[model samples]
Target: MANLRDPVIGPVIRAEGLTKVYRSGPVEVQALRGVDFTAAAGEFVVILGPSGSGKSTFLNILGGLDTASAGRVWFRGLDLTALDDRGLTRYRRDHVGFVFQFYNLVPSLTALENVALVTEIARNPMPPAEALALVGLSARRDHFPAQLSGGEQQRVAIARAIAKRPELLFCDEPTGALDSATGIKVLEALTEVNRATGATTLVITHNAAIREIADRSLRFADGRIAEEVVNPVRKAPTEVSW
Candidate 1:
């Protein structure tokens, strides 16, 4: 378990004056307006915002899926802007894990196979069975996506993301597709992973109820952080309101 009382030694991720602009027709839209943020190692950070607030854009830039129009991103002191396409690909593969709203599992593959597909390429990875067990899906390891419930499939996706033991886990609306009860379970699984492995976790969500589980929460408006709050006592997912 990570020492909750330990001081944040250094930032694992830092965004300095980050900006992203999009050209739609003759109009220019700014998705991120010089956003500055930093996340410490093993910290659980939640970004809250409504649609079009640029939270997703910020996440994409941090995850290496999108490039910033201006400014820079640093991960463990490596300037992301300095990395070329190949370097960015390697950085993502080695240092980051992503969980989106949809479970992008291969329809033809069983849960175990889906996870192993990624672990096979990882430098040092947990076994498929171990990964499945971590997400409480050991019994359903052989089950195909079609055979699992919505929540079960999402758990498999979570297992797949964490099998590589990524230094950072990025989740964007991970519970958006589930019911209230199932969302709670998925959140519980995420909290368990953070507690057990000390992975730096970031979640982007519109659901305010889910914010209580994070160590820090930031509210965004019009492409910038409007407010940031640190929770003195982070609640377990099971204790959070739906």
Candidate 2:
């Protein structure tokens, strides 16, 4: 079994009985119902579930994009629910990095400029060129997003996310916009960052094949954890079953 302490040897993210509900015209929809989860620093975890299974909802709550109606979230002993809007924004800006399915690169900006935009706001960010090199896009730093391929653009997005050296990285449907081949490349880039920087990484995906790359895989169903699996030996992205 993979040791829970292996990731940074300490817990970085913790959720206890997390619950979120939405009200719609006299009906209550429970997106997440009492879900408990923990992600240690430097860990690579995958969250898998079908549509409307609460995977995205879970991620959003952890990332501070949404609030839970019940339960508590503790990030290294700081109760996230206790934080106000400004505090939440500071927490996300200083400690967390987010990657979504869409690249969201500015068409008018070059790859370097796109990354620099975030670095400018970061308290202590790495140079844009250095971040691009880490993602294997140094050669294309001067090129615009429109000039790059899908996989390359995604890599740029990854670089932009990591430029600030965030403590935690959240990826939601990162490969949804790409084909099988391109998606594999994107996954490889993500894993490479996790291994190199030891950043706590959480990926929400519907693709079962991607589980092979995770230290721990969590399966969700009906707003609850259906199963949790640990990979004694996680396969490389290229070697994973697609």
Q: Could you say which candidate leads in lDDT? A: 2
Write candidate 1's Cα lDDT for 1-242 as tens digits: 34422444688889999999999899999999999999988899999999999999999999999999999998876799888999899888988989999999999999999999989888778898998888899999999999999999999999999999888899999999899899988998898888776789999888897889999999989999999999999998888777
TM-score of predicted structure 1: 0.95
How accurate locally, in lDDT, is each candidate?
0.90, 0.90
lDDT of 2 by residue, 1-242 (tens): 34322334458999999999999999999999999999877889999999999999999989999999999997776789888999889889988899999999999999999999999999889999988888889899999988999999999999999998888899999999898899998998899999887789999998998999999999999999999999999999889777
For model 2, where is the 10-residue window of minimal lDDT?
1-10
Name the runs in model 1 displaced over 4 angstroms.
1-9
In candidate 1, position 190 carries an lDDT of: 90
Query: TM-score for every candidate vs. truth?
Result: 0.95, 0.95
Worst 10 residues of 1 by lDDT: 1-10
- Residue 124 in model 2: shift from native, Å? 1.7
